[model samples]
Target chain A: DVKVTQSSRYLVKRTGEKVFLECVQDMDHENMFWYRQDPGLGLRLIYFSYDVKMKEKGDIPEGYSVSREKKERFSLILESASTNQTSMYLCASSLWILAGGPGEQYFGPGTRLTVT
Target chain B: SQELEQSPQSLIVQEGKNLTINCTSSKTLYGLYWYKQKYGEGLIFLMMLQKGGEEKSHEKITAKLDEKKQQSSLHITASQPSHAGIYLCGADKGYGNKLVFGAGTILRVKS
Candidate 1:
């Protein structure tokens, strides 16, 4: 079975503090994604990586960045966190076939971040 | 541009009753996926539909995608207590890293 594990489940940070969220997948998948889920906004993609050192910006990518130094690990970085950034962060991984085919993105337990 | 929209933010029904959730999109969807998210947990994928006017079923649940490619429905036959959760519908143009999700439908099935 494919397993996607996150570094933390609950995190509390002060305003302007830097934070990092880590995600690792053992399925050897080629695509990794980061999304922040809000009540009414649903799940909005923050960043995604297809290969090592390759990253793409999603719809909401402000004040956040991602690093994909290895094939199995992806890290999301918040240079300066704010209260408005408090939300549930989810990491997902999926296998990329030859073309843009339908793939199930498996998600982790998610990390609930609270900034005060 | 808000690609997906789900109706009936919340619903409550008795066990054994049937329920349907709707998802509408502003743009044509190349694919649609249904997922269930429990409280304070991750999402579990239920089904995916690619072709328009297509229907798929699993156990007591059935999903249908309209031919117009703008709307989809998830029908649960004889709702059970275990089926209670936030049902989220998502769509994408092709199958890349990007997907837009709906706000989700919160369902509570009473026993």
Candidate 2:
């Protein structure tokens, strides 16, 4: 079975503070994604990495950045955490099979971040 | 407008009842996925449908992709309390492995 683990399940930070959310996958997938889920708004993509050091912005990438220094690890960074940034952050990883299309994404338990 | 739309934002059903949830897309879907998420938890993949007129079942849950490939439905038979959760449908956006998801359908099973 595939396993995706997050560094933290819950976090609290003050306004203007820097925050980091980490995700690691054991399946050696090539694609990693970061998403924020909100009520009524649903899950909106924040950023994604296709390969090491290669990143792409999604629909909502403002106020957030991502790092993929290694294949198993992906990190989400908040430049300056604000109250509006508080959300349930989720990380997912998938394999890119050119012949068969992208595989299903496996998601971590998610981290609920609270900005005060 | 939303690219993917899910009907009946929420549903309340009694145990042993049957219910169906629908997902419609404005564009043709290359791949459609069904997932269930418990409150404050991550999504658990239920099924994936790729071809038109495809149907897959797991236990009491069945999912079908219409012949047009623009719509899908999930039906649960003999629903139980364990079935209560948020159901979300997602589809590929045609590039970069990006997926667009619906707002989700909240299910509450009354025992």
Q: Pick the lDDT winner.
A: 2
Off by over 4 Å in 2: none
The Cα error of candidate 1 at residue A62, in Å, is: 0.5
**CA lDDT of each candidate?**
0.91, 0.93
Taking all chains together, each candidate's TM-score versus the true structure is 0.96, 0.97
iRMSD of prediction 2: 1.1
Assess chain B of each prediction and give its TM-score: 0.95, 0.97
Q: List, in order, the clash count of every candidate structure.
A: 0, 0
What does candidate 2's lDDT look like per residue over B11-91, in tens digits?
999999999999999998889999999999999999999999999999999999999999999999999999999999999
In terms of lDDT, the poorest run of 10 residues in model 2 chain A is: A96-105
**lDDT digits (tens) for residues B1-111 of candidate 1:** 647889989899999999999999988877899999998889999999989899999999999999998899999999999999999998864656456789999999999
Model 1 ranges off by over 4 Å: A98-100
> Candidate 2, residues A15-98: lDDT per residue as tens digits?
999999999999989999999999987789999899999999998999999999999999999999999999999999999766
- Candidate 1 docks at the CAPRI level of medium
